[model samples]
Target chain A: MKDERTVPARTATQVKIADAAIRVIAQRGFDVVSVRSVAQQSGLSAGTVQYHYRTRQDLLLAALERSVARQAERIRTVGRVESYRESMALTLRELLPLDGVRYEDAAVWVSYGAAAATRDWLAGPYWSGMRLFHDGVRETLERARADGRLREGLTPETAAPLVTALVNGLTLDHLNAPARVRVEVEAALDRGLRLILRD
Target chain B: MKDERTVPARTATQVKIADAAIRVIAQRGFDVVSVRSVAQQSGLSAGTVQYHYRTRQDLLLAALERSVARQAERIRTVGRVESYRESMALTLRELLPLDGVRYEDAAVWVSYGAAAATRDWLAGPYWSGMRLFHDGVRETLERARADGRLREGLTPETAAPLVTALVNGLTLDHLNAPARVRVEVEAALDRGLRLILRD
Candidate 1:
């Protein structure tokens, strides 16, 4: 039988490279980040990084996949909350840049998003990630409406987009103005929840 | 001394450089753009571009200043509308990425914003642009409340953040998922307008 050592070792190396790429891209953005930088960060050779990922775009795509997977896993693990307001608030607050890791993730995602705008090849996964996020919001709202936890006249079809926008907009605001405008974000979140949740 | 011609020529050259830098940065982002690229795009010598702007960050700052000035000028020129609803719609629409030029500006602003998160030197102008955008939204909401155009329970302080978040979130959604979810954005905009506007 052929040696199985190469397979596990290669997989571990790929994960290390991807993690290092995430940190480097988070700090410098996709456009400025180089393969050599990833290698430096990962403590691997440039040749090794290239061996695992064919191009820089490939590496970024892997990273994007990893991020979306993490988000999906979070949603899955968190599952559903008892109340509509708590569910939406919990999902949004989890996604926001409330801590260092999420903040770095937000920064990296924004950079990827900007690059995706110009590069059509990168749009597919990026767009899919956004759709998944929106769909989750819509699903949560629909469940709440079905359970009679949300107010009348506000279907998931109507409320989902608003909630998605509110969460995303508040996240962007927080990322841009972390110090002075955080309270404003919290207030908006509270008001948004109050507006939709049934008494 | 030199000549009276120097001042006008300098001003004209500065305008050319700023316009070129905006185009380049908007296309490739601030970190990826360079003085030589700006010079080539502007049809100026590298020395001339270098002579006018000391560094890429300086060039980006000047371009950012021009963008903010132009946005402020647009709001000024648009002046006050007959009603608060019209004014808010007008301002919010301007922020959207519906057209090509505005899309480019929005994209570039986002890219610069990512950079500004880490680079302290760019933070001041970045935050100021954000403030200008926020203040415009706030003032419009305040005017609406003053004129009894908005619902009784919503004050400017409360409505401003919500409105801002809604518009920004919709714009981001429109950019990210133009094909699949553009209609959702329009619906959200309408719902948001209805939430604040008087019957």
Candidate 2:
């Protein structure tokens, strides 16, 4: 019989290991991410870390999965009082490296993305997560179009990729220019959204 | 006196070494780019490559310089027949991985960008090249605005970053999804530009 406590404890330890991998990747380059480093970062023995994630690739994949889930969750629940446009702005902002946690997420994302470029196996999850994000943008745009808020001649099919690209580009820019004003980025996003979505 | 012929030969050999480094980075992940691999790719001895490059950092910086210079040159000469909008499109296209050579350029670019994200020394060239690209986009948009071809309420200052971001994002996405249709991406780019620029 499985102990009830074991499930929760195992999950908690896995999450800790994943978070530690993200931190290591964020601080060091992706090449530096290994079982030893993650173990040290998590304050657990190497054996314990390996038991959960046998290889660096396993740890990286876990971190990416968690990051994608957390990001998707942020956009899943549209606030009761928030307009679609406002909700979108908030969702896109969640993808940006505006805060420390987000910056770490962005850093690890870039590293993982680079690694995924040459590694075929990692490409599946990388593209899937991106497709999901792009789909979310399309759904939002379609909803706005249905409500007659979207500008004429602008289809969600065509606009969603641009939005996806913009968020990614902005994330990369923000990573290098950490001191860049949040208002400026938000203004860019607002202006971009406004161009597509009528006031 | 030193042989005058040696000068041209040495320069050609250095260029070959640099090109090989770019090819190595493009084919393999950035982590795999070593002095020896670059030498092997160049069809030169390790000693000969090392004599010129000295270190991997030196080789990387040289490759980046060459790539940036090549890209800048592509945008430097805007033909008289090309409209500002057309010229802008051409300039931006230079940044895309549209063809084999450009794909190589883009691959090396992604690898360098990922490395730069973690390395402070790399951050300088990374940001500088980006700033240069951003400035070019801004200049093109400003020219369009001056000609009254820009949409109402859209300033070059406001739109240039979006264009820059789109190109970067598209580049990263294309690196992963190489099979993505060229027309689809071009359509997205066109739609994006049309949103900001008057028809």
Candidate 3:
């Protein structure tokens, strides 16, 4: 079996198709994502796209996998820090769709999540990505506890879900309301974290 | 020319089609909600369904509007209470997807909200439902403030989003994890509310 930890090798054509699939999902939502549309968007023939991804699920899964990998990498970059509070605030903010690219990524994730609700096959990607993000939050909270930076009564296990949910809720709100100011979004995050973290 | 607040009188056939649309959305997700599928599920002809709805949005929006009306009515029935704390808790609990029917409602809302991300026309149902729910929370908070039951530092404006987001997040989590217990979901909400409201 191919190791999920490592990014699978892809030809340039496959990469193009995957990128096109992401754009289609981000722009039109996931249910509308099809091989023909991805091909049209990629400026390639339908057969070429088909050859790269034999089915619609194959194509969309590739796009979902790539997005999750990139998001993991972004979270991983926030290495050991002097303050878990600052590190967390910085990392969670990265997940917010404050700009165009981030908005597209958030939109695709939301689309995938919605589809995954009913389709059992799609649950793997959705849960795995969520696990990674939740684990990251737990790790950050644990570090704060170790360093005595976290509030006296709080534990990572309890706080992780709140933080994860806050970000998820905020991301959805931000994507739907494009007119929302970044300051308000950031402020919401800060307020949530303060409730969990120490002063 | 239709007053949105007024539920349009539906023939038995129209009502059947609308119920089928809700099932389709709850079981299959919203992306597949079309006049043809709804008709197939309802055992009615597509042309008959179309005659009532005029457009796909009209049909789905009707279903959505009906669901919101039912949810609001449920919240309204929570009635006068000795304390804002008890009233708020009782009202918000109605929003949780604790049972099968409630779960279906929450799932359809999430699916519709996800699709509404890219479809501008669908924004009406999405935002209007959200506004009603948010306003309910704000109204509870305002009542608490008037009764002097609210925490000293909390403002309805700030607390409403946090409460709203927490419920939204918890609903999403519960839907994804069907084995989730009602107690845990209720506890999460209680914890979140405690953080926002005074004892």
Provide TM-scores for the models: 0.85, 0.90, 0.88
Please write out the lDDT profile of model 1 over residues A57-141, one tens digit for every residue. 7777777766666556665666556667876676676666566656666666666666676677777777887778878888877
Task: Identify the candidate with maximal lDDT.
Answer: 2
**Could you give candidate 3's per-residue lDDT for residues B1-199 as a string of tens digits?**
7643324425666667777888888888886888898888889898877777777788788778766766787887777677676667777777777776577677777777678887888776688788888888898888778877776567888777778888777776666653643347777777677767765
Evaluate candidate 1 and give its CAPRI docking class based on DockQ: medium
> How many residue-pair clashes does candidate 1 contain?
0
- Tens digits of per-residue lDDT for model 3, A1-199: 7643213316666667777887888788887788889888899999888776778888878888767766677767856555667678788877777766566677777777778878897776778888888888898788788877776456788777778878877776656653643358887887777777763
Q: Best-fitting candidate, measured by TM-score?
A: 2
lDDT per prediction? 0.70, 0.75, 0.74
What does the lDDT come to for candidate 3? 0.74
Worst 10 residues of 3 chain B by lDDT: B2-11
Docking class of 3: medium
Error in Å for residue A184 of model 1: 5.0
Q: For model 2, how does the per-residue alpha-carbon lDDT over A1-199 read when each residue is reduced to its tens digit? A: 7533212113878878877877887788788889899899999999988887777677778888877776777667635334666777777877776676677787766666677878987888888888888888899899888888777778888878888888887777667763654447777776777777775
DockQ, in order, for the candidates? 0.50, 0.63, 0.59
> What digit string (tens of lDDT, one per residue) describes model 2 on residues B63-158?
776677667776676353346655666667777777766777777777777788789878888778878888878887888898898888888899
